[model samples]
Target: MIIRENSMLSRRHLLSLLAAGTAMGGAAGLTTGVAHAQAAIPDITLGDPSAPVTVVEYASYTCPHCAEFHSDTFKDFKAEYIDTGKVHFIYREVFFDRYGLWAAMIARCAGPENYFGIADLIYAGQGDWARQGDPAAVADSLKRIGLQAGLSQGQVDACLQDAAMAEGLYGWYQENATRDGVRSTPSFLINGDMHSGNMNLSQIGQLVDEASS
Candidate 1:
């Protein structure tokens, strides 16, 4: 597997800058920190105990394109592939900032059963949460969202502060992204082949067909 060096600035440095009120505001600071923590982990998979095809996605919650893909194309894909046991879908987090990572952790903390539900909400609400402009406020909003999804405030807070878990996530993303030649958000790996950008259902279906064959 090939690995590529991350070109984005480190999450810690971005958070420090935000805290200092240099590049970003308080909201941005919180988002950056949380997103960094999320980045320090790897992708999580769901669907199909014994599928022939595996589809992995490297995505960021803050990415508009990723959100669009989720909104427009994912339902069909899930219905056809994920739900029917033809494909095992893995969702990996890639952070563009702290907010993105924080969102990822919140989704993960919901546990595997609820991970996709929370992820859908995050992607759907990405515009509102990411642009809220107050780190504490954004965190609180996310906390509330998590609570609605059955996560306690304590659970969300604990997950957010999990440095070791965050590091593991980052390491996993780093390695996977490298191996899959992913340089941008919404990149995909279909049975070890790489495809980038937001793809239509037909395009993905074709890839799935190829993989299965």
Candidate 2:
């Protein structure tokens, strides 16, 4: 899906969107809307921050090809590069729809320490959770993933209902995706050069080696 085509999720409609099965609302006294235009959005990172190569991935949770990369390519990349301190990796969420946004919210709910782990679960179960066929059903599936990732019920509920955080995430995504020229899911910025579509571990390794050189 094209990145620039989607409209921003306005702050005024944020709560209603959540309450209408995008989230488990009734978060007591949650922020009504965006705190400011530049609210702090979480940037989930992996590997050594000072590594020679920086790989930024812009991906949507609902995208099948993205799920394929996670399931097939990411583990090896992480093991050979990220774990070895050869490359620094950052994961940026691209929301193609509210379902994608909701999945990201649940992953972020686990906090940065647990974010990647929850994200892994989300990607791994993308077929089941993303295709549940109704906002509430999909929402419930995401909540289950959050719970599976060790997030408490309270935490999941509060996180899903966080309007301010949601707005910040949407804004952050728009700015980053537009600036980085992302037009599709499973896109990568390898040391600032944009690469689109899925690549095998060997292909990714070649790029990593080139960046290193």
Candidate 3:
């Protein structure tokens, strides 16, 4: 999908969707190059924290398939499992390029509360925002979007420039992807088993049922 310059994905939209859990609690710095050899697999989670089944997804912002999953299957999944408190859905960024990483950073800036909302908007507007020629210009546009979501330009800029947080997120992503053998976007770890790419609602629901059972 071609992301055009006129896309509606603003920095705030990216931030709201991408930044989910980074701000909750204290800032934890991830150790670089740490793989399964260096540390145990961290349980990246979302939704009802105490939900019975946990679903973790490793996704890239620029991935079309991931967007499709978000646009198609995720809503039903959320309504059926996540909203019902049967599942905890965690999202992790699996960056394949600098643009993907930048998008991830912007999402992180929005923090957990706004993460999913912004993520929905970003995925919905992927073709427009991801295809822009000038990333900085795109970022500026995203910042304006964030303002609508209640983030100030100063906050957005600071979050975007947070190199330490970005590096730490990158390190976490690299380590998990390497361990999970994720070679594509929209990979999921449902109760510890790895599933690659977007799945239909029925397929994902079966997994949730199995996990609950």
Winning model by TM-score: 2
TM-score of each: 0.80, 0.88, 0.75
Q: Which is superior by TM-score, 1 or 3?
A: 1
Off by over 4 Å in 2: 1-16, 19-23, 26-31, 34-38
Per-residue alpha-carbon lDDT of model 3 for 76-178, expressed as tens digits? 8989999999999988887665567666666666667677777776777778878887655566656655566677777776666554565556667667766
lDDT per residue (tens digit) for residues 28-100 in model 2: 4344544553459968999999999999999999888889889899999999999999999999998767888
Deviating ranges (above 4 Å) for candidate 3: 1-44
Taking every candidate in turn, the Cα RMSD to the unseen true structure, in Å, is 5.3, 2.8, 9.4
Candidate with more favorable, higher lDDT: 1 or 3:
1
Off by over 4 Å in 1: 1-7, 11-43
By lDDT, the candidates rank as 2, 1, 3
- The lDDT of each candidate is 0.73, 0.82, 0.68
**TM-score, cand. 2 vs. native:** 0.88
Top-lDDT structure, candidate number: 2
Alpha-carbon deviation at 121 in model 1, angstroms: 1.0
